[model samples]
Target: MEFPPLPLFTEVELKSEIARVATFKKVPKGETLIRQGQYLKVLPIVVSGAIRVFQTFEDREILLYYVRANETCIMSLTACLFNNESASYAITDAPTQVLYIPSDYITDWQTRYPSWNKFILAAYRNRYDELLHEFTDAVFKKMDERVLDYLRNYRDTHSVHTIPISHQALALELGTTRVVISRILKSFELEGLIGLHRGSITLKKPF
Candidate 1:
């Protein structure tokens, strides 16, 4: 089913507005759209491909979340609206097509374009709710259970019974130590619940 261009505009208008937005750009795999600890100037919307958002402390970079096409990458509504610095890094997982929007342009569009305004506001709220859910899960769940839930959820979305996330990345995503993640994965492997290999794990059966 087709969604009306986020609510106030015709489909053609929405496409035209976005087209007039800013020049589209291509990013290669492993390149950063925005880096943590740096000042954010522009926010990017993913036109195609995927991006991984992460946070770094000293030498360790913790995985935060993933974004696919049609999702905003820079978290501008949060960082810019609150006048705070960015808290994560956004890096492409594959070669990506994106529209880079200037900060002032977004601010102006919010006043001039009703559909754009509504869409951006909704994206902000949805992302806020998602973070809240993640925080709740972290507070109430055990590490192993969280890991299991994460793997199951990831598998479902990726449409692959196997997941190729690295152990260290999984540790960061689950907010646990790598050793803890390793032990739990080993337990699951021993029970024939999954098959583990270099930098990947495959579910033996559906969750």
Candidate 2:
């Protein structure tokens, strides 16, 4: 299949320039896309499937954000622009297709391509929007509410109600402990909000 068309290039430019500049990769689920502290020589543009970017602490990890179809990771761009290494890990959540454009092209294309400059600014805008959303949830939303939001978004995105994840996994995703998440889950079950099964959580009502 043709790679997803990027707005970074006009149709005529895409046909000649962008296609020539990008290298493509197909990856399977669970594949590591970028490792923490790894050198970034290219900018990853996800054309299909999902990638999870997460930060690792001494004994825990928290999801930083997700990049999926039509989206790019701002940190990846930052690393390339600043000559810094990737500070977080990125892994494929499902079979994925990515377009890797060489880092050198970032600066060069900005002056050479109007769309590239727009896309660069847009990436920062998107990152700010995402950070604000996360901050709002952290400061204003309750843990149970955040859990529900996460599950709801996951279900809508993946088109599934049965989420195959452990309590520990949920805890990590929400930046909390397993014990606390387990307790909240139990409460959800008692309240007819969810159903908990081994290695999974099922929504009992529309969220």
* Residue-wise C-alpha lDDT for candidate 1, range 64-113, written one tens digit per residue: 67777777854544675555688888888778777766666677777877
Candidate whose lDDT is highest: 2
RMSD of each: 3.9, 1.7
In terms of lDDT, the poorest run of 10 residues in model 2 is 6-15
TM-score of 2: 0.93
Alpha-carbon lDDT, every model? 0.75, 0.87
TM-scores for all candidates? 0.83, 0.93
